[model samples]
Target: MIILLIWVAVLIAVLVLYLRQIYSRFSRYGVKHFKPVPLLGNMTRILLRINHFADDIFSLYRSFPEEKFVGRFEFLNEIVLLRDIELVKRVCVKDFEYFLDHRSVFSTSDSFFSRNLFSLKGQEWKDMRSTLSPAFTSSKMRLMVPFMVEVGDQMMSSLQKKIKESKSGYIDIDCKDLTTRYANDVIASCAFGLKVDSHNDVDNEFYAMGKLSSTFNFRQVLIFFIISNAPKVAQFLKLDFLSETSKKFFRKLVLETMENRELKNIIRPDMIHLLMEAKKGKLTHEDIKPNDGAAGFATVEESAVGQKEINRVWTEDDLIAQAVLFFIAGFETVSSAMSFLLYELALSPDVQEKLAQEIKETDVKNGGKFDFNSIQNMPYLDMVVSELLRLWPPGIGLDRICTKDYNLGRPNDKAEKDFIIRKGTGVMIPAIAFHRDPEFYPNPDKFDPERFSEENKHNIPMFAYMPFGIGPRNCIGSRFALCEMKVMAYQILLRLQVSPCEKTTIPAKLDRETFNIRLQGGHWLRFRARD
Candidate 1:
């Protein structure tokens, strides 16, 4: 018994020393950071539900106002939180090749989840990117407008029915539920080549499957936390990000869709069809023009990396992976943005009024037929969206893993020498921190759409606003997401005026538990027919 106690004591002592050494790497390099605890590091408070990913990390960022970069420890990992715009510029664009991959988020054992474009590393990423780039081009988006409109019409039909059945002409809408359903149906139509009236058919298999797959529930939160921090352990244990049911449903759906489409020789203009064309090597660089008629100022610009075609034979798994990736990205992120957009509109009636007027005038100008071009050209609508994203970006932050040893330079002019980020070191860009900083955006908390005005937009510094993400590896589906949200917002605003309901929180407050953007008491609002 005494020998066993000594062994246990030695083990604890070794653990303490090891942890102390690992946590002291920042101080050894003279980098600025708060003292991290043994195991959880700076994330101890976050893990204990005291704070969240954005507010907590942004707080650390705010702690060092004069520093260009700060240290952040995610569990046991050291992530350099980038604060300087020039540093952001280099990391995202100028010297992007050095940091070509995002930090791994899932176990490799999960084929579909791990092999998606977001998870692909190095050359595989480039090939898949160029391969899929044509599917999101402006011309392609033009073809997709009708599909989006069809979904919007379905959503309006469902909402109108609800209002019709109600004693009051207006109905209290769960903004999150409404937007998620609309986004679900839109992605279902555009990406998966299926028609789903999610608002009307609330218990749909596709919608249910998607929600289960993408939602960050309490258990899922723990699973993903482990996966993100200890990927090898996750892979060894086969702790994939997706639930088993989700894997089966999506895999079968994608493969069967491709099979049926190929066998029947049915050609459609949706993403599946485009991906099928890519499989046949029919897609090429010419699909992109100098100006791709991007949906809004908030859209991610197509770069030369995604422009170059890399010849490779696509596989069945590869195809399924891309389809699933696009589905999850389109479903979750777009829904989050749409929900937030509606919340903001409900809060600011003047913005909604102006947006509705623009929609009405544009509809009249187009002779009651507003297409992709007309909607994209709406300056006020774009400005509102830009501001909305700046205030509540769907993605709280961005992460990149350094592939090669690179000099990160000084934390600030105050520091003596350069700080080198070694290979495999993780770097984080606090997108919300930059977006909400008073220096870049005056009165950052205020909902001011005029900041994105044509005259004033250029005055804003580059790399300050990254709603989708930053650089060539930014959110690939920004075009589709923007178009999806805009089309639905136009449909809703043209018919309904949203306002605060009894359940609505006056000022938005974040839910402390989840990493995703969600309101504290739910996103509830009243939607009535326009006067």
Candidate 2:
């Protein structure tokens, strides 16, 4: 008992000394400090379950609307949550080179997917980004449009069958589940060039895994909390994000596909095929089929670093990691965006009517078919999507770390406070707080699509509207994801009438425990054919 007491005393003293250091550091920068507790820092209330972290962040931002930035501690680490729109602009856009990488806890080697775009940084990120850029270009998306349309057709057919088979004349739909399957079809066709028919097979291995990744339980959340909070120590211990099952499944899948493609000359216009072309120097060559995977390059450019052969192919691990990440990131964003989009439609019938009119007119102009240009050209459709993203961003927070000591200048207009960012300090750009700021957005609680219209969009500050992020490191698949979502929405709206169900939450709230911005409960809505 005496030993336990002594150990507790030592821990308290250590915590106090650490906090005093942080406090002194903030004082030096002339940044305002939040009243913090001993061990858990400013997040004690959140960690103790007294309040949700998102709400706490919102409150903090609201409390000091005049300040350009606020200083707070997350345990021993100092975090600067920037509030001023211009300051955000500096971090994400104008001066992005200084804060390029999102702080990821996992090491690439610990799993097959270590070198994914999300985890890569610096020169490595630049090279990979350049290589993958052409894959998602307008022409590339045009090539893949037929596949996306086919998936949407399959989804509509599947939903019709489910509705027909329903005993109550109304099918109860788990919006997340339906959207996940749709996303599975999208990713499968576009990423792997394989069609698993997730619409018919809810239990399909890929679909199940995708759904599991989106929905987390208590244990998974706890493990994530630990890893994120102590990433360096976790990395030193060789901890990984990919579960053993996911690692085995994806690694085997990518390797077998590569081998089969090489043997059979099976070329496709998907991401895997593009990466394979990069490996063999055949990106510019036309008429290369999947079976032509063995096609060798005309010339191999030397690696910029000169450490590797220019024609050196990606290893099996590299292919698998990239493939898995493509599926994981691509699927979640598409599915979540659909969920929220539908959630909005259910709540606002006037908005739905306007969107339906837009869809109908565009289809009529396109020879009664929802062609590429028709769907892509609808201006209101684009604004509605943008507004959905602005109100409920697919991600709640965007994170970065100070790679070098930098200056966060005070608000140029208001001149409230200034601060120096130290290296290794983690920065959490609370996207929700920024999106909901009434000062930047008038009557922010209301769902307003006109906010994204051509003239109105300019009224908003530059960095204030980044759903797909900004800078060179922004989401590479943004166009693809948007295409898939728009296609799905067009097909569904054309065939069926959607209305909010009792199970749907009128004002959607988030599950704080989950890592991403997900609904507190699953999005549920009723669908009827528009006959």
Alpha-carbon local distance difference test for all models: 0.86, 0.72
Q: Which consecutive 10 residues in model 2 have the weakest lDDT in total?
A: 292-301
The parts of candidate 1 lying over 4 Å away from their true place are 291-293
Alpha-carbon runs more than 4 Å astray in model 2? 1-11, 45-53, 214-216, 236-238, 284-313, 411-418
**Model 2's lDDT to the true fold?**
0.72
Against the hidden reference, what TM-scores do the models get?
0.97, 0.88
Instruction: For model 2, state the Cα shift of residue 83 in Å.
Output: 0.9
